[model samples]
Target: MQTAVLSSRSLRIALPLAAALTLVACAPMSTMYSQDSLPDAVKVPAGNKVVLQTVGVGEILYECRAKKDMPGQFEWTFVGPDAVLKDRSGMQVGRYYGPPATWESSDGSKVTGAQVAVAPAGTGNIPHQLVKANPATGMGAMTQTTYIQRVATKSGVAPADRCDMGSAGAKQKVGYQADYIFWKAS
Candidate 1:
């Protein structure tokens, strides 16, 4: 259809539709955060660099335990995560867990991070965080993982009803997804 032959009414609709499509095409894709926009913390020295970026899928386990120093009271205590870490192609490549939140690779290399900062990920969603690694825990592919950032988390919390003393020893496994960015020390 030649543009010069279009009817006035048709042109009116087509012009605006075309413009809208053009704008949409040029818009940036939205994500939990981009590198520059990600949360920052002094604990993770800026001199370090990215080593790996993986997506983790699994459960955030929890157990109801008596609150320490608060006799007769109880609370839900985190029992560590159990997740399969995958590369960009979605190939399972490692694991995520520990009170230390370590990432262990198939090659036997790993990195353990201590959380340094957290940013909320909308309501009901887990917060994203930045973490600094404990000194010298890497090997093989993880040779220099000195920092980490966990973001784009989804669904990993236990229900409130399961957090009381009556439910002590009870366990819950809630599924979740998040991006784990590993870093190397300078």
Candidate 2:
């Protein structure tokens, strides 16, 4: 009888522990990957412009580029405070040409892929916003939101309104701004 009681108690404890372990083993890994998982050197193909800059409280420098080879592709890479990138429409922000990823803003807005744009060399400040936070890890967490504004410019040859837009507006020449916000994680 004592043996039966002890066996039942052990089974009760062991079963839950085993089940928890199994669930953890079957769980999907985190989306963020380690730096070592990436290539040590990234080769930039010809006819692409690379822009590197530092933003946010930590001054995290990021390497970004606009490539003509892909014909309508933009890429950006940055490391900074833990943040949630968003758009003016309150959608989660994402890359212009990379993965088919989506994000949701804190306000529960769905950010899509049609709100991003790349500007020429002489375009105005690419309006961008970054929300900074610090996760438990020492590394600062940052969320960056970017958008291009539609501006009407008058050209001597054609006296018409040239509106600039994101990917949705290809033929327009609108202005864009980059806005950033900072928040400390408790």
Candidate 3:
């Protein structure tokens, strides 16, 4: 049987194509978030890169109260949130809760942040949010956190229960789920 051989013309084209494919395959893969499609208001600032990503499964508490500056009008007012933070692997790594909004790791490192901006997620969903992290409280996973983003919101909106004077002082807990992406300065 005669052996087939590649012509010099074919070798020139095939070699470069094969080399390009090899380079691409060997390149480091980045699973990091590309916040490009997110709304500008909720996008993290430049010079930062994703450090950790966790899902927050939780509830938001709301209390029926008189609408501020509107006598006799009542509505549901935000109380706070309580959530369990889990990594993509479904392991519990931390928690999120508070009047001041804290994120704490299982290692005991914790952080609180100030809201930077928020953008509408959708109808019947809480807004996506960006926060600027405060200095961490312990040495661990959260120590270098510079920003946190709340995204992929499900539910977590204000309770739709009757909130007239009759319902005043009543509290409601609404279940919610969201992804919290943590970032650090690159």
Most lDDT-accurate candidate? 3
Ranking by TM-score: 3, 1, 2
Arrange candidates by lDDT, descending.
3, 1, 2
Alpha-carbon TM-score of each model against the true structure: 0.73, 0.22, 0.82
lDDT of 1 by residue, 67-109 (tens): 9999999887878898999876666778988766778887888
Model 2 Cα RMSD, 1 decimal: 17.2
Q: Give me the displacement of residue 183 in model 3, in angstroms.
A: 0.7
Candidate 3 weakest lDDT stretch, 10 residues: 1-10
Q: lDDT of model 3 at residue 30?
A: 38
**Candidate 3 ranges beyond 4 A from true positions:** 1-31
lDDT of 3 by residue, 38-64 (tens): 899999889999988889999999999
Candidate 3 global TM-score: 0.82
Q: Which stretches of candidate 1 lie over 4 Å from their true place?
A: 1-33, 41-45, 136-138
> Residue 96 of candidate 1: its Cα lDDT?
88
TM-score of 2: 0.22
